[model samples]
Target: MKNDEGEESRVLLENYRVLLKKALDYLWERIKVERREVKKGKRVITKVKVTLSKKEEVYKSLRDELEEVNVLASHYVDKAISDAYSVLRSWRRRAEKGKASLRKPKLKRVYVRVKSTLRKVEGESVRITVRPYEYITFSWSHTWFSPRVKGLELGEPVIKEDKVHLPFRHRLPWFTPLDYLAIDSNLYTLDAYDGEKFVTFSLRELYSLKFGMELKRGRIKSFASKHGRKGGKLMEKYSHRERNRVRDYVHKFVNKLLEMYPVTTFAIKKLNKQEMFQDADDKLSKRISRTVWRSIHRVLKYKAPLYGSLVKEVNPHLTSKSCPRCGRVSRKAGLSGVRGVGSPWTGN
Candidate 1:
């Protein structure tokens, strides 16, 4: 009886996720495109219109079909009656009126992303597609490709099948006692403080590959200076490699911290970010799991529940500031120039 109930609940949650995902994709897709444009020149609100058939079955995979439309948007834009600026204005007006349709409405587009299995129809324009459902697909095709494409390949967009299960964890109750500690992550080190002990490790150990790439890039740049290679391409390749090193640095740090300092509560610095661009949609985005702190949190969530560690976020606002002596505020904590500098022994 419980197994059946669990299955039903999972299905319901997945369906709910699918519905919300569609609505989010509508607004989010445009934002991603605009961000790329902002990186190129300026930031602008680009709205694209979409039209959805009122008939449900008529659009077997409605959301998937919309994605298809997004991929082929460049093709549409090329053939659009309005230019990029003009179409954006038109889209804004209609969106303000809350009349954006999902049934192939004209949308002013300024940016686009390369999703999974995306293939560009090479001719006068480039096109891409996403196979969302088993038999359904979403696509994008365009001529005005944004230059701010960092790490992306035009292929089929990866569609994550939603799954909501009890977060797998390994933690003991408060009643159970153990002698272990783990520090959280910060800008300096991966895990700075958990609650009891400070976890410290070298960042260089995990990202040896990155260090090697950096050395290779330096050689390439040197070669370029001697008219043998292009430094720009070499730098680009090296930067990505180094960034991957940082990601692995965090992951290894988190795992080691957890193992060394076993505790029920893992305290970490809560980062304040307006928007985090995670690479979950594209093939490369999959590697984003390593860069973001989300990876550590995920591990703690799953592994801690079975053990005794529990992940917790510290109030990053007053961490470096707020003198513990008189409760004054300082950015450098009186190290540089500020008032009410508390001592290191003040329960920091």
Candidate 2:
């Protein structure tokens, strides 16, 4: 009896995995076919008519095919169609800018998007419909997630590996201003000026960790060239570790800063990263690319409301070059020249 139950569970999981792969393949094929039609002048890629018509065709085709693959739901098929178009759109944008080589989207991994209608939350467990009259329930012990889960409306869940990730949406309360902190985000540190007082958070350690990871990656690559697939896995493992470490550090740092200050408003410079890094040197550009400034800004913006704070983007033009006191732009006082605390104008 135990062996029979275990075998049934394994089969059910395998069926879901197979369905996900088929969905991915079906979407990719549709995209390729549409692209060929566009090139042959049989179809026009318009914002409304053509786009809607193509999507309808793809959705209908998938729906028809899902009769054979009975385990996959219609809503999940629709989501896959949307995901395929999203990938194509992104690729088209990059190709237009000559930033990437044009190629069809590949399915290296399986992702199944499950709508809320197909999943039910019962106590600590979520019952998901895998097929008609077939369901699977997953339980969790994380009590901390219960309150957040109850508060917000949950979006479609994404299934990857053995775990399901649920996305939630909620409205945040508006902040009433008490004080503003003007922050200048740089490569080495975040320089913050709250009218009379100035504070700097050093990010040198983050950069150091990044550089160390890069060094390790280089060594791993060299070994991979000689030792085959095992070395490649090692490289991927280290790369993932490095990314998680940086993300964790940034989250902690931002949380601490917001807690310490308790400011009502945050003023940060609007960063145009692409334009800024276009002409920069290779090494410096790589370092800047790994800094995760955008991630930090996103974290700050989202988390600020929880503390009754609002984030604002100020114009970055001549922010560092111009002296705050005299309002004069100094061409000679570059980033290197503006070292060590106090006013850049006074050079203290």
- TM-score list, all predictions: 0.35, 0.59
lDDT tens readout by residue for model 2, 303-348: 8876778898877766776554456777854656444322222211
| Candidate 2 residue 3 C-alpha distance from true site, Å | 18
Model 1 per-residue lDDT tens digits across residues 161-224: 3321111122246743344333333322353433444445443354345446657777877776
Tell me how far the alpha carbon of residue 1 in candidate 2 is from the true structure, in angstroms, after superposition.
Answer: 25
Task: Report backbone clashes per prediction.
Answer: 54, 0
lDDT, residue 110, model 2: 56
Q: What is the lDDT of candidate 1?
A: 0.41
Off by over 4 Å in 1: 1-199, 206-250, 272-302, 322-348
Clashing pairs in 2: none
* lDDT of every predicted structure (CA atoms): 0.41, 0.66
Error of 2 at 31 (Å): 8.5
- Model 2 lDDT, full chain set: 0.66
| Candidate 2: RMSD to truth | 8.5
TM-score of 1: 0.35
Per lDDT, the best of the predicted structures is 2
